[model samples]
Target: MNARQPCRERRQRRYREQCKIDFEIRLLKLSILRGHEKMTRATEDIIDSSRE
Candidate 1:
């Protein structure tokens, strides 16, 4: 085995890990946005019912 192969392998592993983390972050943001929208709808419903 040579030194260059190990370096290249390490870089590839790091790149894969970074990609996974980015994907997870995007999913988390999307879920949070959906939750916020649901909360807003619920609040609106309550306010609307109170006005009746």
Candidate 2:
């Protein structure tokens, strides 16, 4: 109904975009960490098998 409403809506949109970006970043980091752990476990298994 006024100019202030448009400004408020713009700010809300920006905030939502920021949250989306942050969530994606977090997911990327978590997947990277999980992949690293899997690699480490695979290497350890290879070492164990070689020792036998």
Candidate 3:
């Protein structure tokens, strides 16, 4: 029973860590996508201004 308790705890801890890592990765990806969108918009504005 003692051995099982340790194993279960370890598994739960690992699962929590993995979840945290996944969440962080998703947040980073979202930020990167937003940056790309902003850059694209800025480029478009510059081109339009040049044409005018």
Candidate 3 minimal-lDDT segment of 10 residues: 43-52
Per-model TM against the reference = 0.64, 0.68, 0.65
Compared with the true structure, what per-residue lDDT tens digits does model 1 show for residues 5-35? 9999999999999979766765665567678
Candidate 3 per-residue C-alpha lDDT over 1-52 given as tens digits, one digit per residue, 9 for 90 to 100 = 7769999999999999997976676566556767877546665455446434
- Better model by lDDT, 1 or 3? 1
Count: clashes, candidate 1: 0
Best by TM-score: 2
Candidate 2, residues 1-52, lDDT tens digits: the string is 8979999999999999997976676566556767877546665455446435
Location of the lowest summed lDDT over 10 successive residues in candidate 1 = 43-52
The per-residue C-alpha lDDT of model 1 at residue 16 equals 100
**lDDT score for candidate 1 against the true structure:** 0.70
lDDT of each: 0.70, 0.70, 0.69
How much does candidate 1 score in TM-score?
0.64
